[model samples]
Target: MRILYGVQATGNGHITRARVLLPALRAAGVEVDMLFSGRQPDRLFNMEPFGDYRTCRGFTFVTDAGRVRRLGTLKQSRPLQFFRDYRCLDLNGYDLVLSDFEPVTAWAARRQQVPSLGIAHQYAFYHRIPGTGSAPLLKWSLQLFAPVDEAVGVHWHHFNAPVLPPLVAPSPYPLTEEEGKILIYLPFESMDEIRYLLRAFPEYRFRIYCNIPAPETQGHLEFEPFSREGFQQDLCSCAGVIANAGFGLCSEAIQAGKKLLVKPLQSQIEQRSNAVVLEQMGLGRVMPSLETEAVEDWLALGSGTPSPWPDVATALATWISTGRQVPIQVLTRELWRAESGNMLSLC
Candidate 1:
């Protein structure tokens, strides 16, 4: 089947998930074309995985100092161009369209009267789950931005729902001895602030990854350019992770059994809700801001037991290739087993 896959480029998490799913789809003998939206065309990195994907001026949020800037986001959005691009897309030859919460391709598929499937964490909001930041505008944006026929949501826990486990990169690095170091990836925050926050913890070594450049070294802090290889290497050696309460990193950290300290982005409902759930599940600790006390407290705690990460990419690919006609409960069970790491009969 010929498929059109749309991925949101706002944050690296969406791209990271797509990286895992794309290869699985190809291995299943599906012809796929990709479209990427949100963020400028020039800002993209690690382009090797996504082969010649289309680009558009799709929706994205604006953030300042670790907070989602609502007014800034509105001022920056280009609605006219967004509409024009949506109306102009041609979905004539494709058998199916898949979206990772990308707006342009979803709207185009809707306009063309084509069946579309939404594969994203955002879709989980439709179900009964823990949530925060419940303004009418945010709700409207999520629903209208990426509408789809079938929604397949991913989460860290099942919550007695049909959500699947997070799609992590195939484990490239083996688990290593704890080196008393911490990996920090808070892309939404300013580098200066991050540096200041870590300076207080002189005993712990911090390897920070950021988009902006940094000086050679501070007393106990080392700044590095963002590279998948470098990040993974640092992560393997680190005892824990200090990052925003974003789903992708948190899920991966849990699978690795690393201790976690997350700071949910301000005014971001999804992130705030994720933090709440993470606390409830005993998966990690959440902080309202990048406070030193919280980081120190998290560092003092022991790591949780590793949760097994099943081959979710393979399972989902198999289901899609078979035409996705299975009952929701059956699919949910299969996915839950993969997430839960328990071998029990699905009655």
Candidate 2:
């Protein structure tokens, strides 16, 4: 079967997910082609998994110091170019189209009358999941941005919905936790600001990765560029993780049993919702902004227990191979039972 998978490049989560899912699909004996959008093609790294992928100038949100800059995003969107790209896109030969919240292929499939499936965390919002910060505008954007048919949502938990577990990168480095070692990945925040906020915590060592042009370090805080190998190594070594409330990183941290603290992007519904669910499940802590108080409070608390999650990538591939629809309840129950009994749902 031929598949055209669309991934959003605005954040690393979709890219990270593709890194695992693509290989699983290939192993299932399915031919897959990936179309990535949002960031420039040159900016992407560790792309060997996609294997001769295609890129397009896709729409992306602009952010400034942990908050979405609406005006800047509006100014940056090339609507005419987007319309042209939409019209020019061809999904004629593909048997199925799958999107990870990518607008290009989703819209293309909608217009061309091709079968489309959305497989991403964002789609979880379609159901009554744990969520907060609901604005009609952002809600509308989420719906219209990536329109699809018969969607499948992935989350840290099923939330008694059709949602499956998050698909994460396999542990590349063995878990050798270093006490007081923290991995900070707040890409949307200012470097100087993150540094300033973290300076007070001199007792702890931080390995921070952002969009730095080069690698550098300051005192106890180490700054590095986007390196998948280096990040995984540090993630494996660190005792905990401090990052933006992105599902990708938080999911990885949870799966690895690392203590997690997240600062959700301002005015972002998905992020706020993620934070709410995480906190609700007692899996992690959330800070409203880059405020030091929340950090102080979080640091005072002990690390939460890590919950074992199923290998969702392989399961998804197997499910896709079988045409019959299996309920997520059945899928999660069997997979979780097979993987580990120490579930956070135990609480």
Candidate 3:
């Protein structure tokens, strides 16, 4: 069967998930094409897995100094281009269109009267799960942004719902974490501010990944451009992670057993909610902004236990190949056990 997979390219999490699913789908003997939206195609890197992919000027949230600005987002979004692209996209000859919280393919599948399945963490919001952004408007935006007929939500826990555990890819290198090194990936914050923030903590080393022209290392801090190999290497070796409260990186930190300190982007319900849930679950520490106090507090704490990442990609691929006729709970439990690898059950 042929499938068109839609991935939201506004952030790295969606792309990271696609990396896991693309190979799994191929191994399951499913033919698939990919479409990325929200970010420009040139900004995407280390995208070797999706073969040839398509892109569009889909909507993206605009941020200023670590906060999402709703007004700016609307102003920046080229609605005319988005509409034209959506209307022109052809979805013929595809057995299914899978949306990973991506808008173009989701809308196209609906307009063209084709089967669409939304397999994403955002879909978990359809259920009464924890960590939902509070504002009703944000809630509505989540629903309308990526509309789909069928939903397959993924989360860190089942929450006694049909949600599956987070899709995490293991570190490609051996896990030899450096106790004094930390990985910083706060894309929304300014690099100069980050450098200033870490200056006080001269004892620890900081490796930051952001929109740098090239690699540059200074006293106590190293700044590098976005490279998948380099970023993963730093993450695997780092003793801790300092980043925004994004799902993908948090999942990676947990899987890799790295100490985590997160600052949720203001005005983003998802990030704020993620922070609350992280504190509630005792998974990580959260600060509203990148302040020195939070960093000091986090440094005083120990590296807590990280979650076990399940091999949901392959199992989900199998389920898709089998027509998704059975309830996903059966597959959810199957994959949850496999994630545990006979060590622990998700609480």
What TM-score, computed on C-alpha atoms, does each candidate reach? 0.94, 0.94, 0.95
Q: Which has the greatest TM-score?
A: 3
What residue pairs are clashing in model 1? none
Evaluate model 1: give its lDDT: 0.83
- Relative to the true structure, candidate 3 has a C-alpha RMSD (angstroms) of 1.7
Candidate 2 pairs with clashing backbones: none
- Candidate 2 regions exceeding 4 Å error are 136-140, 324-333, 336-340
- What is candidate 2's lDDT per residue for 1-347, written digit by digit as tens? 88999999999998999888999999998899999999999899988867889999989999999999999999999988888887799997998888999998999999999888888888877777667435545546667999888777888766667777788866777877788888999999998899889988999999999887898978999899999889999988888889989999888898788888999998788898889988887778888878888777777777655555668899989887675388756876766455446664422
Clashes of each: 0, 0, 0
Q: Which stretches of candidate 1 lie above 4 Å from their native place? A: 133-140, 213-215, 340-347
Candidates' lDDT values, in order?
Answer: 0.83, 0.84, 0.85
Report how far residue 274 has shifted in candidate 3, in Å: 1.0
Total clashing pairs in model 3: 0
lDDT for each residue of candidate 3 in 1-347, tens digit (9 for 90 to 100): 89999999999999998998889999999999999999988899988877889988888899989989899998899878878888899998999999999998999899999899988888777776665635656546777898888889887767777888888776787777687798999999877788889999999988989897898889888888999899999988888999999899898888887889999998877787778878887788998878999999898887755455878898889889889988888888877776665224655
